[model samples]
Target: MSEYFNTQALALSKSFADAAFKAHTLAVEGLERVTNLNLKALETNVAATVDFLSEAAEVRDFDSLKTIFPKGVNLVKDSAEKFYANGQEVFGVTVKTGEALSQIAKGSFEVANDSFKKQVSAAQADFSKQVNGAAKKATR
Candidate 1:
């Protein structure tokens, strides 16, 4: 009985550890994806700003200024769209990671619950057998 309990305890411990590791891995991967997306967005934004500045610096007359103004406006619009898209991507990663973590937790809980039920049923059966044997001996 002691050995059985020790084995069960070890198994449960390993199960929990495995679940934890999986959750951690998923979270890290999601974070990595978000970081990469942000970095890319930053790079694009910086490049666009630099280009716009360079264009403005080249302005020599009112006509050139008019062209640069429209370009600047377009840049702002494009940047806003990119920002929104990046936000959506990050949200998607977060939701996916959360769902995966939830699944890991749920699976661990179910496994532990089933193990506990089996142990209880076995213990009850063993107790019942012992009681019947004792009663028979007493009658004899």
Candidate 2:
């Protein structure tokens, strides 16, 4: 009886540990993806800023100013579009990670519940057998 209990306990512990590890791995991967996306965005922003500054510095007359103004407007529009796209990518990663974590939790719960039901059924059968044996001996 003790051995059976010990085995069940070990199985339950291992299941919990495995689920936790999976969750941790998913979370770390999601974070890494987001970090990479942000880094790339930052690099692009810096390069764009430097290029725009270089162009603006060369302005020496109205003709140069006219050309720089249109380029500056285009730069702002492009930057906004890039920012929106990066935000969507981050959100996608977050949603996927959350779904994976939820699946882990659901699977763990189902395993534990099934184990509990089996243990209860076994205990009930053992108790019934003992009771029947005691009644027969008393009658004899």
Candidate 3:
């Protein structure tokens, strides 16, 4: 029955491959969900941070520039939301987006990786449980 064994082995290989493919697809979809949620959250945080800093940067001096030609930006009257660089002042709210974008980009990458792994593990576990249930029923 060597031929029989060979046929069984081939079938087993194909089945295993199919299972793995399905698992991968499920994992990827789950990862996307996690990414979407986190991305939305980050976008909100960025927007909020920009608004907060815009109202406070003049006091914080975040632009890293704004001392040489201090002719226009009056620190006292301007809304507390201002940033400067090289002694040059700018709208603090504008630059906060770039910083927020960077943070979200980096954080999203890490978060996606972690979520992918967790989802893969969960998919595999669920697949194994179903397979085991079938085997148990067949044996019974």
Candidate 4:
């Protein structure tokens, strides 16, 4: 009986450990996705800013300034679109991570519930056998 209980306890501990590891792995992957998206956005913005500044620096006369005005407008429009696309991708990754986490939680809960039920049934059967043997010995 003691050995049976010990084995069950160890199995439960292992199950919990496995679940925690899986959760941590999912979180780290999600963090990496977000970090990569942010870095890409930052790089895009920096490049656009540098180009704008370079153009502005060359505008020494009215004609040069007029030439850069349209370019500046186009740069702004392009940057806005890039930012919007990056934001949408990040949002999609976040949603996918959320769904993955939910599935992990549900799977873990179901496994634990099933293990607990099996352990309980086994313990009940062992107790009944022990009781019957004790009663028979007492009568003899």
Candidate 5:
């Protein structure tokens, strides 16, 4: 009886530990992905800014300004397009992370539910057997 209880306790403890670990792993992965996305976006924007500044610095006179103005406009347009694309990519990552986390949560819940059901059924059977044994002893 002691051994049985010990085994059950160990099993429950292990299940809880496993569930916690899985949840932690999923959270970390999602955070890492978001961080990477933000970092990439920041890096791209910084590089674009540096390049634009360098081009603008080259403009010294009215004729040079005229030549640089169209290029500056094009640069702005290109930067806007890049930012739009990056935003889309970030959105995609966010959606994927959400779905992945949801699945993890759902799967863990189902497993825990099944484990609880099985434990309850087993306990009920054990209780019934013990009661039957006590009744036989009383009759004897």
Candidate 6:
């Protein structure tokens, strides 16, 4: 009876440990994805901004450039703001998710550690009992 209970408890403890590891892994991966995607988008935006400046600078005529400048500036402003807003939104979501996952992992670790300590103590007690029983039998 004791063995069976211990076996099932062990399995439950292992599942808890696995859940903890998976939670941590997901948090790390989620953060990485958010950071990578934002960096890539920002890089593209910067490059495009630089290209726009270069082309605008090369304009030989003010009337022609003026004809183009307003639309170009507006386009850059609108699209860049959208990209930055999206990056912020995604980054915030990832941070929140990661924090929640981290908390779950921490809780799981505590539960697993407590279960392990109990299991070890029970095993030790059982060993002591068996040894005392055997010595008494031998003395008799």
- lDDT of each candidate versus the true structure: 0.91, 0.90, 0.51, 0.88, 0.79, 0.77
User: Which numbered prediction scores highest in TM-score against the true structure?
Assistant: 1
lDDT tens per residue, model 4, 1-140: 78667877787788878888998899899989999999989898899889899879978999998999998899899889988999999999999988998888888878877887888789889999999999999999
Clashing pairs in 2: none
Tens digits of per-residue lDDT for model 6 on 1-140?
37846775876678687886788778777777778777877787777777777777778997879876986887688667869787787878787887778777777777767776777787878888989999999999
Per-model TM-score, in order, reads 0.88, 0.85, 0.41, 0.86, 0.78, 0.56
Residues 1-140, candidate 5, lDDT per residue (tens digit)? 56555766677667767777877886788778878877887898788778888988988899989988887788788878878887888788778877877776677667767776777778788989999999999999
Q: Please give the lDDT score at residue 38 for candidate 2.
A: 88
Q: Candidates ranked by TM-score, best first?
A: 1, 4, 2, 5, 6, 3
Model 1, global lDDT? 0.91
Evaluated at residue 38, the lDDT of candidate 6 is: 79
How would you encode candidate 1's per-residue C-alpha lDDT over 53-93 as one tens digit per residue? Answer: 99899999999998789899999999999999999999998
CA displacement after TM-score superposition, residue 132 of candidate 4 (Å): 2.1
Better of 5 and 6 by TM-score: 5
Compose the digit string of candidate 3's lDDT tens values, residues 15-133. 55655565566556555655665565556556656655565555545353444124224432232232212112222322443455455455545555555566567667777998999
| Poorest lDDT segment (10 consecutive residues) of candidate 2 | 1-10
Query: Cα RMSD for candidate 5?
Result: 2.8
lDDT of 3 at 6: 61
Worst 10 residues of 4 by lDDT: 1-10
Worst 10 residues of 1 by lDDT: 1-10
Instruction: Score residue 123 of candidate 6 by CA lDDT.
Output: 80
Residue 92, model 1: Cα distance from true site in angstroms: 0.9
lDDT by residue for model 2 (1-140), tens: 56557767887898899999999998999999999998999899889989999989999999999989999999999999999999999999899899999999999989977886787688778878989999999999
Clashes of 3: 14
State the local distance difference test value for candidate 5: 0.79
Best by lDDT: 1
State candidate 2's TM-score: 0.85
Better of 3 and 4 by TM-score: 4
